[model samples]
Target: VITSENQLSFLNVTRSLEDLPVEQGNDAEGLLNECKEAMDHLYKADVYQSFDEPSLFIYRIDIRHNGSIHSQTGIVGLVPVEDTESVQILKHEEVRPERSDLMSRHLVAVGASSSPISLTYKNDEQLDKAITNCTSNEPVLMTEDSEMKQTIWKVVGETAKELSELVSNKILYITDGHHRMAAAEEALKKSNKNYGPLESTLAVLFPDDEMLVLPFHRRVGDPEGRSSQDLLKAISAVCEIEKSDETTPERIGEVGLYLDGQSHKIILPKSNGNNLVDQLDVARLQEHILAPIFGVVNPGTHKLIDYVPGPLGINVVKERCDKDSWLGFVMHPLKIKDLMDVAEAGELMPPKSSYLMPKPRSGVFVRDLNREKNIQ
Candidate 1:
């Protein structure tokens, strides 16, 4: 989550969108012009370096959490936008059209993409070996903070060609940046030119086994002023509820409910042997609890419901509840295989279902859309 402080500090440095000072009553077009001006200044000042030749990069991020270090490595490059239509790249989440439109405008205004859309694929021994070999040498760029360290290595010559070929035939699943992908498509539609930087989007492809998936907990407000007992009674009509000490569910079909300052276990009924989307815990929560009792049919746009990232921990939910008469549900993390399966089936998951960690940070590598050309 990028807090206000983070946005302010970032604006202070980049002077790019988000919390940057604009004229009073300025419209979207005006803000976009400001963004273009900021980007122009950045390019003029040489804030970004351009490579003379086509190249791929190996990006690795090591995160220290829970007394252990988890490392994920991937190849960063440009993925053809056509892959989405060809089904080579699959998306499991539905994006809001407004958000996608805004992103598309941003792409057009900036003419560059700083953050790479994250993609995941089935694990391959050869690909893993090649990435390991590349990382064996000293990295060309390294950045570190207290909890995470990021390293980048440039790949060129035959090795880059080999790496590209290895992933060419593999089906890619989007782990993040669904909006960006949608935005890229929208931008392509606006640009009548067939081949150029608009033909592709910056991406980082990681293997499924190396990527970490976390849960997105839900919290809902009681606008109707229903008591805790009344809410539990309504929930119990659909699911089996029992008092429990656990704040996080241990397995699928089980949900941890924090209501009235107490934790309870909710056991969901078995799903019918059809529709993989219905089998998801988040879907079940919507179908069983959020929709019926709270009348929250669309969690994405619902004003009373909000999502809390699992990495924030259960205490964050508790703190929110303490401030208001809100109830929280802790969800189990979705398995990587299940996500890939749903994407392969061309089905969408409920909003705020999964939180992928160790995301690639922006400003590490920037692609100049004006200079890049898609060579077919």
Candidate 2:
């Protein structure tokens, strides 16, 4: 946690999340760390992470694809984060503590988050119409997601009345940013006399009908770690390999591994592997291929292998691998049902495997966890 015992005031900073300023040269992890540092540097941060009830946040993700307009549902409220034997909140992704610890340290010190974890709940048709009636008039923040237009509005007054009434039966589930939520839990645990077991951090809540899930594509560096032959051999045990004298994977369950222009499809065999996790595409690549042939255990955290969200499609992957003949894997996006099932079962998906969007850009919404007491 960033120790705000220094110059920044932890509370009452700025408004209009976009006006915060410009940033560059940062991957997802780097950008979040930068936000933590910014809060500590510019705002009065706290020495300890005090316990504040998790509050609902009115969020919006405006997407403009072609001529169509899709406005995402956003909510504001306190979420429960506790280490109870029976966990109330469910999560789809697993959190790495070290990563979370870094975020917690930053958050506790500066008391600000760069982004809201994107989460969706079981679909409630009734709730959908009410939320729409409230948000249709105006929006809080209207921005762009890649080429899609994005916008959001805070729910208050009459609008809030509808939200407050609807959320009574709401059971929030986190779809992404598992690490960030874990860090909040960690920070609360290490706080002063003010620590509370259940406090909601700012999150974007949407019903099952309104939720969108995207698959994340995987790429590996040159065949240096594993010779092309060894890699093919390992993949062959699980998949049906079709040697391509050409380039790229052309179909589903087909992955293209290229070493300096030599491309092949690392397709899995008809027979499925045992164990749910091992059966996954990412798992097969790691266990049979990456570890045995390439010697890389956690490709998720690997610097050489980059991940691209499926929505961006394969063009970006082609651009990244063109120079060195990098290996690119195309995956079918995970179904929403699978994501929720895993989360409810308390299992974490492979890191970087799921990319849920449209991502809620930080600075668009500012949540002062430190000032939660005065909110009422």
lDDT of 1 by residue, 247-300 (tens): 889899999999989999999876653789889998888887888789898899
* Model 2 ranges with Cα > 4 A deviation: 1-58, 64-71, 83-86, 140-148, 157-162, 168-170, 192-198, 222-234, 243-252, 256-259, 262-264, 270-275, 302-304, 374-376
Candidate 2 at 289: error in angstroms?
2.5
lDDT of each: 0.85, 0.61
Q: How close is every model to the real structure, measured as TM-score? A: 0.93, 0.73
Those runs of model 1 whose alpha carbons end farther than 4 Å from true positions after fitting are: 1-26, 373-376
Clashing pairs in 1: none
lDDT of candidate model 1 versus the reference? 0.85
Give the Å shift of residue 96 in candidate 2: 2.6
Model 2 per-residue lDDT tens digits across residues 1-376: 1223434433222222232335543244444555565565554444333324332345665676336756666675545566222455677566667678766766665566556666677867777777667666676455564655655555556656666667655555777767788888777778752644226566677766666666677777644666667666666775677768644455544556655445676775332445444455566566656665555677767666778887686667767777666677666555667677666666766777666666666555556665654554
